[model samples]
Target: MGTYLITGIGRGIGQELTRILLSRGDRVIGTVRDPGQVPAEWEAFVKNGRLELLKLDVRDEASIADAASRVNEPVDVLINNAGIIGPDRQSTLNMDFEGFLDTLRVNTLGPLRVVQAFLPQLRRSPQAKIVTISSRMGSLSYAKSDRIAYRASKAAVNKVMQGLATDLAVDGIAAIAVHPGWVQTDMGGSGADISVQQSAAGLVKLVDRLTLKETGGFFDWQGDAIPF
Candidate 1:
């Protein structure tokens, strides 16, 4: 079974991904900002050695480095899922600069930092994949400006993922950004279209079929390509 390292698995999509992976007998190394608050359902997996939880905060470099240092096994897949919705004051005409900066730090740069810290373990894998949980709201082609800070951060991250795909090609490490559809979560709200279960299921399927050919492309939860 392949070993997958997922960030922010305390709840929402990341937590669901962990559930699916662990149920299928795959090893999962999940990261969360608070380890003590992890789900009680996961106690069995943690005791079985099939699941490992690392305390990490995407905004903290020291935490990411410390988490990476603890993982000695090769990670077949790395899912950068930790992100923020950004401050409420995000807008084109008016913005919270500090909050915007924090958004960029977590949503855009956090994944890259985690990848750099975990490169050694990724390289040890026979075939490695890096998946960043991006959003369609970030698409430049969309031309929508609401919540500009969040959009801009996602847009910038999409570019970063493309560059990573290019640079990591020689190493046979596939990196791609995925747009998880609007789902009913704390961020997506109750009015959202899909459920976490559906999104997570599709994401796992898409990630399983990923190859170098699809490394630079952006895709939806259903495996359909999206314009970045």
Candidate 2:
């Protein structure tokens, strides 16, 4: 089984993805801002060395680098799943500028930081892939104006991932952005269309099918192509 590195495994899609991968015999290296936040049920995996948790805050480059340094083994896949919904007062006309900047810091720049710090381990693998969990709201085709900060951050990250796909092609690494669907999580709320289980499962299947040909593309949780 492949070694999968995932960010923000404290809950939601990240946690589910870790669980699925571990159950299938793949080793999981998960990152969390607080180690205490991890579920106790994963103790078995942790004890068996199938799951390893790293302390990292994506917004902090030093922390990301430290975390990356701890993993010497090749990482076959890296999933950038940590993100924020942004501030409550986000809008085009009225915005929380500080919050908007922070949103961009975490959502847009965070993935790049993690990827750069972990490039060595990724390069060690014969086939390496990077998947960023972006949102459909980031799609330029959609003109919705709500939550502008969050939307802008996702859009920016998508562009960054596309560029990464291009630059890393010579290294034989594939990178792409994916919309995990409106999952029913703390962030997506109860009224969301899909459950975290469904979204995580679909995402794993999609990742399994990914190849160099699909690099730099945007796709949904259901594996459908999406306009960026």
Candidate 3:
């Protein structure tokens, strides 16, 4: 089984992805901002030898570097799933600048820092896959509506993933940007259309099918390329 590293494992899609990966015999290295936040049920998985949890604050670059150093084994896959959405949900004019910057720190810069810090481990892998969880709302083509901070941050991440895909191509690693769909989670809210399991499963399938040809393209849960 492949070695997988995932962030934001405290809850939602990240937690479900960790569970599914472990069930399929893949080793999971998950990061949670607070170690205490790890669910008790998940502890059994850690105890049984399939999963590992680390305290990681994605907003902190030093923390990212420290965590990256702990992965002694090669990482076949790195899923940048950690992100945040503030509760205000305001329009750009009414949005809080501090809050907007906070979202950008977690959603955009966090993945870039992690990918940079962990490049060594990823380079050592036989088939390296860097999967950044982007969003349709991030699509500049679809930005007739307003989400202000989230939209801008995710859109920036999409570009980051695209550039990385091109730069890392010679190493045979595939860097993919994917929208997980409107998943029912804390961030997606109760009205979202898809369950976390459905989104996670589809994402795993998409990652499995990733090739250098598909790298740098933004995609949805069904693997359809999303317009920039």
Cα misplacement distance, residue 221 of candidate 2 (Å): 0.5
| TM-score of each predicted structure versus truth | 0.99, 0.99, 0.96
- Residue 196 in candidate 1 has what lDDT? 97
lDDT of 1 by residue, 123-165 (tens): 9998999999999999988988999999999999999999999
lDDT of model 1, residue 29: 96
Candidate 1 ranges beyond 4 A from true positions: none
- Which candidate leads the pack in lDDT? 2
Regions of model 2 farther than 4 Å from truth: none
TM-score of candidate 1 against the unseen true structure: 0.99
lDDT of 3 by residue, 1-228 (tens): 888899998899898888888888888999999988877887787898678887899899999989988888788999999998743764766877788888899999999999998899999998899999989988988745577788889999999999999999999999988999999998899999999999999998898888888989999988999897
| Candidate 2 lDDT tens digits, 158-225 | 99999999999999999999999999999999999999999999999999999999999999999999
The model with the greater TM-score, 2 or 3, is: 2
Clashing pairs in 1: none
lDDT of each: 0.96, 0.97, 0.89
Ranking by lDDT: 2, 1, 3
